[model samples]
Target: MTFLKRGVPLGIAFLMGVLMAFQYYVPHEHSKAFLELMTRWDKIIAGFAVFIGAYSLFHLHYTRIKRRAAGWGYSFFVFVGAFVTIAFGLYNGGEAFWHDKKEGTMFDWIYMNIQVPAGATIFSILAFFMASAAYRTFRARTVESTVLLVAAIIVMLGRVPVGALISQYIPVAADWIMGVPNLAAKRGILLGVSLGAIATSIKIIFGVERQYLGGGD
Candidate 1:
C-alpha cells in the first residue's frame, strides 16, 4: 500500500517532471512530438477533472444543505443556479445539444444578464475596500512610506485631467516614476517568483515535496 500510494506516484512525478523540463531545451523533432502528445493527454485529463470538480462542488453543497449548516440557505441557490445554467446550456438556444452555442441563446442571456452583472457588482464593491486599504497604506508614517505616498499621489493625479492643468511636469514625473522605478520593482519580484517556482519544481521532481500526495515532511 505504501509503494502504491507513495513510491509509484513519486516515481511518476519525477519522470514526468524531468521529461517536461528537458523537453523545453530539446530541439529534436521527437521531443516536439512527445510534447504535443503530452499536451493532448493533459487536455483529456483536464476534461475529466472538470466533471470530478463539479461533482465535488455539488456534494459539498448537498452535505451543507442536508446538515442544515450555517448559511445552508445559500447552498440551495448553488443547486438552482447550476441546474438552470446546465439546462440552458443543454437546450442550446433551441438547437441540438451538440451544436455550438451562439448569441441570443438562453445560456448567453443568463451569462450576460445574471453572471456578468453579479461579477461587476462584486468588483465595484471591491473598489471601496481598495480605497480603504490605500488610505491606510498612504499614511506617511516614515521616510520610506512618505516617499511611497508621494509617488502614489503623483501617479493617481497624473492619470486625471486636473493634474495636467496644474503642471505638465507632474505628469512627466509620474510617467518616469512608473516607467522606471515601478517596472524595476516588478521585474525584481518576478525574478524572485521564478526562482521560487524553479526551486519548488526541483523539490517535486526529487520527491522532497510530497504535500501534493497528501503527505508532508
Candidate 2:
C-alpha cells in the first residue's frame, strides 16, 4: 500500500521529469518524438482534469443548495448558467458536433451577450478599485513615494494627447522613464521569477519537493 501510494508515482515523476528535461538539450529525433507524445498526453490529462474540476464545482454548489446555506440562492443561478451554456454547446445550434459553430449560433450568442458583458463589467469594476488603491498608495509622503507619484502622474498625462499639446517635453520624458527604468525593473523581475521557477523544478525533479503529493496523506 505504501509503495502504491508513494513509490510508483515518485518513480514515474522522476523518469518523466528527466526525459522532458533532456528534450531541451538533446537535438535528437527520439527526443522530439517523446516531446510530441508527451504533449498529446498532456492534452488528454487536461481533458480529464476538466471533468474533475466541473464535478468539484457542481458538488460544491449542490452541497450548498442542499444545506440551504447562506447565499445558496446564488448557487441555483450557477447551475442554471452552467446547464444553459452546456445545453447550447451540445445542441450545437442544430449543427453537427464536429462542425464549427456559426456566428449567429446560440452558443456564440450566449458567449458574446452574456459572458463577454459579464467579464467586461468585472474588469470595469476592477478599474475603479485600482484607482482607489492608487489614491491610497501614491501619497507624496517620502522622497521615494514623491518620485513614484510624480512618475505616475507624468506617465498618466503623457499617454494622453493633451499632454503633448500642453508641453512637448512631457511625453518625451515619459517615454524616457518607460523605456529605461521601467524596462530595467521589469527585466529584473522576470529574471527573478525565472530563477525561482528553475529552482522549484529542480527540487521537484529530485523528489525534494513532495508537496505536490498531498501533505500528511
Candidate 3:
C-alpha cells in the first residue's frame, strides 16, 4: 500500500508522459480510448467537486448566522435558499428539475426572477461601460486614430438602421472586420487556452497539482 502510495503513481506518471508524447503520431483505438476515459474522468471529478463548494458555502453561512453577524439576515436567506433547493432536488429523486411544478416552485422562482434578472442587469451595466470605454479609446485625434475611428463609426452605423440606407458595403466591411480579424484573434486565444488547460490537466493527473485535490499545506 505504501509502495502504491509512492511507486505506482510515479509509474503511471511516466507511462502517461510517454503516451502523451507519442499520441499525435499514434492515432490508434487505444489512444482514442485513453482520451475518452480522461474526458469522462474529468467530468465526473468536476461534478463531485460541486458538493465541496456547497458544503463550504453552507458552513460559512451557518457560522455567520450562529455568530449573529451584521449580515445574519443575508446568511439566513442563503441558508433558506440552499436548503429549499436541496430539499426540492432530493424530492425529485436527486435529479435535475424532473419533478412536478409544485416540487420545485421556490427553486424555479428564485432562479428565474432573482438570479436571472440580476445577472442580466450586471451584464447590461458592463456592456454600457464597455461602449463608453471604446468611445474614449477610439476618438479621432490623429491620422491613425482617424482610421480606427472611421472603422468604429462604420461598424456602429452598420449595426443600426442608418448604414444600410447609405451603402451596403458598410455592413460588409463590418462583417469582414468582425468575422475575419475577430475570429482569427479569438481562435488563437482559444487554442492557447486549450493547450494551457490540457497542460494543467496533465499536471493534475501526474500529482503535480495537489492543490486542486485540497492537498496544500
Candidate 4:
C-alpha cells in the first residue's frame, strides 16, 4: 500500500519532470513530437481537474449546509448561483443544448448582467481595503519605510495632472525612480523566485519533497 501510494507517484513525478525539463533543450524531431503529445495530455488532465475542483467545491458547501455551520446561509447561494448559471447555459436561450451558444444566449446575459456587475462591485469594495493596507504599509517608521513612502507618493502624484502643474521635474524624477530602481528591485525579486522554484522542483523530482503525497509522515 505504501509503495502504491507513495513510491509510484514519486517515481512518476521524477520521470515526467526530468523528461519535460529536457524536452525544451533537445532539438530533435522526436522531442518536439513528445512535447506536443504531452501538451494534449495536459489539456485532457486539466479538463478532469476542472471537474474535480467543482466536485470538491460542491462537497464542501454541501457539508457546510448539512451541518448548518456558521455562515451556512451563504453556502445556499453557492448552489443557487451554480445551478441557475448552469441551467441558463444548458438552456442556451432556447436554441437547444446541442447548439453552440451565441451572443444573445441566456448564458451570455447572466454573465454580462449578473456576474460582471457583481465582480465589479466586489473589486470596488476591495479598493477601500487596498487603500487601508497601503496606509498601514506607507508609515515612515524606518528608513526603508520612509523611502517606500516617498517613492509611492512621487509615483502617485506623477500619474496625475496636478503633479505636472507643480513642476515638470516631479514627473521626470518619478519616471526615473520607477524605470531604474523599481525595475531593478523587481528583477532581483523575480530572480530569487525563479531560483526558489527551480530548487523546489529539484527537491520534488528527487523525492525530497513529498508533501504532495499528503500527511506529515
Please identify which of the two predictions, 1 or 4, would achieve the higher TM-score against the true structure: 1
Candidate 2 lDDT, 1-217, residue by residue in tens: 8898888888888898998998989999998998999999999999999999999999999999999999999999999999999888877988756787655779888999999999999999998999999988778899999999899888988999999998999999899989999999999999999999999998888888899899654
Each model's total of backbone clashes: 0, 0, 0, 0
What lDDT would each prediction earn against the true structure? 0.92, 0.91, 0.77, 0.92
Worst 10 residues of 2 by lDDT: 95-104
Q: What is the TM-score of candidate 2? A: 0.91
Question: Each model's TM-score?
Answer: 0.89, 0.91, 0.62, 0.88
RMSD of each: 2.2, 1.8, 5.1, 2.2
Q: Distance from true position, residue 176, model 2, in Å?
A: 1.8
Q: Give the 10-residue window scoring lowest on summed lDDT in candidate 3.
A: 208-217
Expressed as tens digits, the lDDT of each residue in 46-103 for candidate 1 is 9999999999999999999999999999999999999999998998878858987666
Q: Where in model 1 is the C-alpha error above 4 Å?
A: none
Return the top candidate by TM-score.
2
By TM-score, is 2 or 3 better?
A: 2
Clashing pairs in 1: none
Instruction: Enumerate residue pairs that collide in model 4.
Output: none
